[model samples]
Target: MSVTIEILSGLGAKGPAAIVVEAQGKRLLLDAGGALHPDDTITWANNLDVDAVLISHDHIDHIGGVAELAENVPLYCTPLVAKALPHNRPWHPLPERGTLEVEGITVTTGQAGHSLGGVWLHLAVGNGVLYSGDACFESSVFPFDTPPKAAIALLDASYGSYDQPQAYCVQAISERLDQPLAFPVPETGRALEMALWLAKEADRRQLTLAIDPVIRDNLAALLALPATLRRPGLDHSIRSLLARQNACPPTLQLMCDRSDTPEQWPDHHLLHTGYLTPDRRAELAAGQISWQRWNVHLRASHLVALADQLGATQVVPLFTPFSDNALSAWHGLLGERLCTAQRLYAPSRLVTRSSLGSFACPQ
Candidate 1:
C-alpha cells in the first residue's frame, strides 16, 4: 500500500480532470484536460510522464489532452470513447470492459453514464483510491455501479449546490410537450447526463425529442455502455436497444434543426443552451414554443449524501483556484468537509507578452 496522490491539473471548478496517481514507485497521470479557471491558464501543450493515460470520458475538460497524450503515452479508454477523441490523435487504445495493467496498477473502466467512455478508476493502494469521474447518483435510467471498496474515494460532487429544482424542472419540462421547448445545453458531459433522464421521460410519456445533431452523434457512440455496465440494474428495455441500436439517446429519430418553427414540431421540444438567448426566445415564444433555462447540478443535500455514501469526510476541490465557483458553492454545502486544491496555476507569467498577445479567437 504505497500510494501518494497529488493534485495534477484539475483543482477548482474544473470537472473530471487530471490527477497524479503514484504508487509502488510508479506514477500514473489520470485525465489530463484543459483548465477552465478564471484566467484561462489551461495550456494545450505536451507535458506528462506516466506508463499510460486513462480517460474517464471524451469531454473537453476531461480529455482535452487526448491528442496531446497520444503523442506521448499509450492511451486507454472504452472503444466508444476512443472513437469520440480527436481524429488527429495516434492512440494505442485499451478498449472498454477490461483493465490496463501498467507498472502493477490495474486501471479498470466502469460505466459512468455521464458520457460514453465515462468511467471511474479503481486502484489498490495502502487501502485504495477509486476515482469517480463526473458521476451522478442512482436513477431509473442509470444506476450507481461505481466501486464500493474504495478506502479513498475521489468522487465527483460537481453539483455541490444548495438547491436546483430538479423535481420541478422534470415536471415543468414534461408539461411543455404540447409546446416546443428548446434546452440548448452544452453538447457533452453533464448535459448528456440530463438528456438521459429527459429521453426516458419522453419515452414514458410518448413525446418526441428534438436534439442537435452534434449532441445525437456524440451520444450514439456511448450507446454500448449499458451492455458493458451490467451492474446497477440498467433499464433492461432501453439498455437492450443501446446494444441493438442507438435508440435511448434517440439520435437516429431526433429532429435536428437550425430554424425555430415550433408549429411543425407541435408534439416535440428542442433542448439547447445559450443558443436560446433573449432575442431567439422571443421568436420561439409566439410559435407554441416554451423557453426556459435549466442548469443540472447537484444539490447540497445530494452532495453530502453522495459523499457520505462514498464514506468521504474530506472533499477536495479539483481544477479550480481558491476562488472558484465550485469551491465557493461547497462552502455552503460541506463547510468543514471541504478541502483546498493542491497546486494552482498562473500560466500568463510563464510565457512572453508578445506570445500572449497573438492569442486571438479565430473567425
Candidate 2:
C-alpha cells in the first residue's frame, strides 16, 4: 500500500493548520484551519471525502476550518478540544495513548505537549508515520509524555534552527519584571505555562499579576478537566502564585481573546509568545517595543534529537517557511534520509511504495 502526506496548510506561520494523510486508500484529515490572509484560500479538505479528522489541539487556527467540512465525518479530538468547538454534530473524544482503526489503518495518538490536550499521531501503515502536531518538548505547567517511535517523522520546527534553554526565556522575562510586562499568547498552548511562570516570578519579585479574562477562561477550562489528565496541582499552583487583583501597578499581564489596547498604564513592555513576522519585528524594532522570542514550538535541535531518539530514517519538516540553516542541520544529521515534502510526494519520485514501508526515502 502506498502512503502520501499532502500538506494542505500550515507550512508557514501565516497559513492555517491542516494535513491530509492518505494510505491504503484511507484518507485522514489532520486539522481544519482557515487561512490567515484574506486572499489566501483555505485547504481543499472540504472537497475531499475523508474518513476521519484528527484534531491536534483546540487552537482556533487548527479548528476554524472545521465549519467547512462535510457533515457526518467523524471528528476525533480530546475532550478539551471537543468542549471548545461548536458541536452541532457529534465529535469523538480521542483516548490517551489509544489506537483507533480508520478504514483498516491503525492510527495511534500520543500527547503533543504543546497545548492542554495536543496530540502527535503514529500512523501504522506501509512504514509507520509519526505526525508531530505543534509539539513542545518542555513546559513547567503542561504535562506531555515522551513521543513514540516511527519510521518516518513529520515534525514541527516553528523556530527554524534557533535553539536555547527554557531558562533563557524565563530569565529574559524576569529581568523585565522591573517594568510592566505584557505577554500575548494563544489561550490554549503556552498561556497557562507562561501565566503560572509569570505569576511565580512576579510574586518572587513582589510584583502584581493581572490576567486577561480570556486567559482566565482558558486556565479555568484546564482546571475543570480531570486532574489525572492535567498536571497535578496545576490549578492550585497557579492560584497560589497569582497576585491579588487589587494589587498595584508594574504588573504582569497575560493578554488574549481581544485585540484592543488599554487606555493607559505604566511604562509597559510587550513580549509576544509566538511566531513573529518580519513586518511585526520591524515595527517592534522601530518602535522600540519590548518583545521576547518566547514560544512552546519545537526548534530544529529538538526535532533532530527527537528523530534520533525515534531512530527515524526519514524526517519531514512541517510548519516551516524554509529555513536554510535548519534544513542544513537536518541534512547534516539525517544525510540522504532527510526528505523534503515535495520530494516525498513528487509524481516522478523514485521512492516506491515498498521502500516507504521499510524506512527509505527517494533520493
Candidate 3:
C-alpha cells in the first residue's frame, strides 16, 4: 500500500478526533484525542503506535490524549496550541503554510478558523491528504486562509447539513437583547468568536460589554499571539471592549460558569449560547433564558462544496456520525467522491508531484 488511513476514533460525538496515517514508512497520528463513551471517557488513542502527533487545536476532544503520549514522541501544532498544551513533551511549533519534512513525508499547516490557534494539515504522501480538525468557514472574527487542495480530505461534519449561517445566529441572539445579555460559552474555540461579535454588537448599539475573567484572559492570549494569526482591528476591538467594561451601561456579559442562572437573573436578558443539548434546552424551557445554537463546524453544503473546491477525490466525514439524510445530501454533491469512515482507506496510488498553493478567504 502506498498510503493507509485508519479512523481510530473521532467518527461521532462519542468518539475522539484521532486518525492514523501511515505513509513513507512513518505512522503519524492526526490528533491524540480521547473518546467520550456513554459511561466513561475511553482512551482509544492508547492503542495506536505512532511516530508523531499532530494537534489540530487545543480543544479537549482534539488534544485530550496528548499527555498520555510518550515523552520521546514529537508533537507538532501551531504555536498557540503548542504553548497551550499542559504537557511538557517535545512540542514542535509548526509554521503556518511552511512545509516540514518528517521521515520523507511532507506536511504543511493552514489556518483552520475554528479556534484561537487551530490549523488544518495538508499531508503529501503518495497523493495529498488534508485533515481538517474542527473547522469553521463562516467566522467573521477569525482569519481563515484559503482551503488547500488535496486528493483525500478528512473533514469536520459536526453539524451535518445544518446550514444556519453565523450571521443569522448572531442576529437571532442580538434581537432578544433589550437589556443586559449574558452568554455562557466554552472557554475557547467559538467563545472567542462570540465575544468578538458581542463586542462589535456592543459598539454598534453603544453599550458596555463585560467579559468574565476566563474570556478576558483568552482575549489577552489571542492578542499576544503573532499578528499573522489575527485579522486586523480584532485586537483593537477587544481592547475597546475591555475599556468599556469599567463603565456601567447596557452590557453583554461573558460568564464562564453556569452559575449565572437565567431563572434567577430575570432582570437581565440571558442569551446562553452553546451546543443545544437536552439539558440546555431544558434550562431554556424552565426559564426565560433564550438559547442560540452557534455552529463552529462546517454545514453539509459547505462541507461538500469545500471538498469539490479542494479537488478531493475521496472525502471522510468527522465530528458527528452521518445520517442517511446527511449521506444523501453529500452523495448529491460528491457522488462517488464522498466516502464515510466504515473501514480503512488504503490507496495503492503512487506519489504525484505537488504544486503548493494557498487558499484566500472570502472578504
Candidate 4:
C-alpha cells in the first residue's frame, strides 16, 4: 500500500489546516482545520470519501475544523483530543483510535508528544511511509519514539532545525535573579516550563524564588504536569492536578519578585502578548518588568541530535518550505547520514541528495 501526501496548506494560510493522504485508493485526511491560508480554498470540503481522518492533536490548528470534517468523513484520534473538539451545531460524532482497512491499506497511529491527543501516522503496502505530524524528540514534557522498518519517513520539521539551547537566555535570566527582577513569559504552556525549571534550580541552590500571583496558577499547572504528563496530546495529568486542588483562586499575576510558599499561587503565566496594540507595548515596556520570550520548540542543535538518533540510511527534511541552512547544519552533524529531501510532492527533480554509495529505489 502506497500513500501520497498532499500538503494543502500550513502556517497561517487561508485554509487553516488540512493534509490529504491517499493510500491505495483510500483517503485519510489529517486535521480539517479553519482557514489555514489567508484565502480559504476549501479544497478538502468537497472530498467526502476519506476512509479515516487522524487528528494530530487538539490545538486550534489541528482540531478546529473537526466538527466540520465530521459532517463528511469518519475521524479517528485520541479520546482527549476528541473531547477537546469545539463545535456549535451539536451531535457531532467523536473519532478515536481503532484499526481499520481502506483500499487494501492498513492505517495505525501512535503518540506524538506535541499537545493533547497528538499523534503520528503510519500507512503501508510495499514501501511504507511514517507521517510525523509535529513531534519533539527531546522534550521535558514527553519524547515520542519512532517506528521500526519503514522505507520512507515523512517527518515534522517544524522545529527540525532546533539544535542548541539558549545559553545567552539562561545567563541573562540568572544575572537578573540576583536583584529583584521579573521574567515575563507566555501565560500558557512554555511559561510553566520556565517556572518549573527555575523552581527546581532555586530549591537545589537555596536561592530565593518567587512566582507572581498572576502566574501562581500557571506554576501550579507546571508542577502538576510532572505527575500526569505520561505521554503526548493529553493533559490528563493537569486535569487530575486541578481535581486535587482543594481551593484555587480565579487568577494569578506574578507581579512581585518574591518566591515563597506554594499556596501563594493562582494559575497561568504573564505573557507579553504581541496581539496587544502599540499603546499596550509602550505601557508594557515602560513598566519596570523583565520580559522573556522562550519557547519549548526544538532548537537547531536539537534537530542535529534528532538526525543522529535516527541514523537512518538516509536523512531527509519534509514539511519545511525552506531548509537549506538547516540541512547544511545537519550535514555537518550527520556526515554520511544527512541527505537532501525526496520530493514527495513537487515538480522539481524528485531526488535531492544521495550518499557516496546508495541504492536507487527498485522501479
Candidate 5:
C-alpha cells in the first residue's frame, strides 16, 4: 500500500497547522490549526472530510479550528489537551505515551517537550511517518522523548535556520531585566517553566516578582501529573514557587499572553518571548517593545538532530519562511533528505496492515 501526505496549510510560511494523510482507503487529519492573529481567517477546514482528527496539543494554532469540523467526526487528544477544546465537544483520550490503533492504523505517541501535555505522533504506514508538533529539546522542565524510526518526518521548523543555544538566550534576557519589565506568555507552554526560573532569579537579585493566578494554576496542574511527564529534579522548585505569594507593585511580572502594549504598562516595558504576531512584529521593528526568544520551538541544530534520529528519508520543514536564503541554509543542513513539496508519496516495501490490539496508557 502507498501513503499520500498533503499539507493544507502551515507550509512555506508561518501560519496555522493542518495536514491530511491517506492510506488503505482511510484518511486522518493530523491537526486543525486556526489563525495566529485575530484579523486573519482560516479556510482549510471548509468542506473537509476525514475518518478521524488527531490533535497534537492544546495550543490555539493546533486545536483552535475544531469547531469548523463536523461534530460527528471523531477527535482524539490527551486528556489535558481536551480541556482546551470548544465546550461540549466530545473527544477520545490519546495516550500521553504509548501505542494505540486508530482507524485500522497503528498510532504511537511520546512527549514533545514543548508544553504541559503535548505529544509527537508516529503512524505505522508506508515504512512509517512521524509528525513533530511544535517540539523542542532545551526546555528545563519538559523532557524530549526519543521517537521511533520513520521514512518521512513532518517537523516543526518555526525558527527556520536560526541556531541559538537556550543558555545564550537566557543570558541576553537577563541583561535587560535590570529595569521593570512585564512578560506575557502562554500560561500552559513556557509560562510554567519561566515562573520557576524567574522565582530563582528574583531571589538571587533581591527583586520583587509577581505571577498571574492562571499561571500558578497551570504549575499546579503540571505537578499533578505523573513524575515522569516532566524533567526530573525540578519538582522542588515548582512546589516552592507555588507556595510563594505574588508580589504587589512588583519589579517584574509574568502574566497570560494578550495584545499588550508598552503604554498599557506605563511602569514596565513589555518583553515578549515566543511567536510574534504581525502587529507585535511591527511594534518590535519600531522599538515599541523588546523581544527575545526562549527556545519554545526547535532550533536549526535540534531540527537536524531530530531528522537524523528519525532516520527520515523525506522531511518537510513546516511553519517557516521559504526564502532563498533560508532554503540555502536548510539545504546545507538537511542535504538530500530535505523535502519542500506540499504533497508527498512515501513508498515502502513493508505491508501497511497491522492487527488491532488493546491500547496502553502512560504510567
Candidate 6:
C-alpha cells in the first residue's frame, strides 16, 4: 500500500489549513480554510480537486472556504458545525463520535475539545492517518476524545512550544480584570467558558457584566447537544449564566469577536484572549490593547502528550512558525518523530480491520 500526504497550506506559519491525503487512488481534502483576517485571500481552493472534503469544525479558517469549492464535491461535518456552512450548501452528516467510510476509506470523528461540534478526523489508510483540527485538552466545557493510533499525525501546533498551564493563564487574566474591560472572543469557541468565568468574577468584585447575545445563543445551542458532547458537571453553571440578565453600563463585557480597535470602546479597554491577527499584533505592540491566552488550543506539553497518545511515528505540527529557532525547539521535543515536509510518503504496510477498533470514541 502506498499513501501520499500533501500540505497545500497551513505549513510554517499561523494561517489557513488545507491538506490533501491520497491512498488507494483516492484523494481526501482534510480542510478547506479561508483567510483568518478580512483583508487576506486564499489561493489553495483555486482549481482544487478531491474525492471528498471533510471539515473538522466551523471556524472560519477551517470551513470558511467551502463556498469556493465546486458545488458537486461531497462535503461532511457534524450537524452543529453545518450551521456555519454557506446558506443552502449541501453536506453529508459526519458523526460526532463514530466512524464512516468516505471514498472507500474508513474515517472516524471525535470531539476535538476546542469548540462545539469540532472533531478530529482519523482516516484508516496505510497505518492510519490522523488530523487534529485546532484541538485542545483543557477546554472547560468541551471534551477531547482519545483517537486511534496512526503512523502520520497532522497535529495542531497553533501555540508552538509554549507550555503554560491553563491555571496560570486564568490567573494572569484575572489580575487584569480590575479595570473596566471588553474581551472579544470566538462565540462558539471560548466565549461560553469565559462568560461563565467572567460572570463569577464580576459577582466577586461587585462589578456588572454583559455577554453578547450571539454568544448566549450559542450557549443555548450547546446545551441542546447530547450530554456526552460536553465536559461533565457544567450544565448547571451554563444554565445559571444563561438565566442571568446583562447589566446596563457593565464594567466587563464578553462580546463576539470582530475587527475591534481600541477606539471602538472608549469606556472599556480591549483585552484579547485568543489568536492575534496581524492588525491586533500591531495594536499589542503599540500598547493599545492586551492579550492573554485562554487555552483553546494545545500547549507544548499537551501537544507532546497527544502525539504520544496517538502513537504517531511521523508528526507534522500545523499552523505555527517554523523559524530556525522554532525548528530547533521542536527538535528537542519531538526528536525523530518530527516531520516538517510539505509532501510525505508513508511506509508501505497493510493495516487490518481489527487494528481499527481503537477508532471508536469512548462512551
lDDT of 4 at 58: 55
**234-352 in candidate 4: lDDT tens per residue?**
36443443343222232222242232222233233333311223443554576522344343443455444444433344444544445466556656755775545322331121222
Give candidate 2 misplaced runs (Cα > 4 Å): 12-14, 37-40, 87-89, 226-228, 231-235, 239-250, 260-267, 277-279, 323-326, 343-363
Q: What is the lDDT of residue 198 in candidate 1?
A: 61
lDDT of 5 at 101: 86
TM-score to native of every candidate shown: 0.65, 0.84, 0.87, 0.58, 0.95, 0.96
lDDT of all the models against the reference? 0.53, 0.68, 0.73, 0.47, 0.88, 0.89
Give the per-residue Cα lDDT of candidate 3 at 25: 77
At residue 179, candidate 6 shows an lDDT of 95
| Residue pair clashes in candidate 2 | none
- Evaluation by TM-score, superior candidate among 2 and 5: 5
Q: Candidate 6 residues 90-205, lDDT tens each? A: 99999998999999898988889899889999988888788999998888888888888788899999999998888899999999988999999988999988988998899899
Task: Estimate the Cα RMSD of every predicted model relative to the unseen true structure.
Answer: 11.2, 5.7, 3.1, 9.6, 3.9, 2.6
Q: What is the lDDT of residue 155 in candidate 4?
A: 53
For residues 150-240, write the lDDT of model 5, one tens digit per residue: 8899999999998888889999989988999999999889998899989999999999999999999989999999998888898899899
Task: Compose the digit string of candidate 1's lDDT tens values, residues 1-363.
Answer: 346676765555444377777777677777767543324545533455677677776656677656556465766666666766777565555544445576666565555545445666766554546677765443223334445344455656554453554555556655655544545455554444445666666677665554455655555544545543432344453343344333343421333334545555444455442224354567666654455434333345654665565455456644334556655677877677676646321111111111001111111
What are the runs in model 3 whose C-alpha is more than 4 Å off? 12-14, 35-39, 246-251, 257-270, 276-278, 285-289, 346-363
Q: Candidate 1 local accuracy as lDDT? A: 0.53
Determine which window of 10 residues in candidate 3 has minimal summed lDDT. 354-363
318 Cα displacement, candidate 4 (Å): 4.7
Clashes of each: 20, 0, 3, 45, 0, 0
* Better candidate by lDDT, 2 or 4: 2
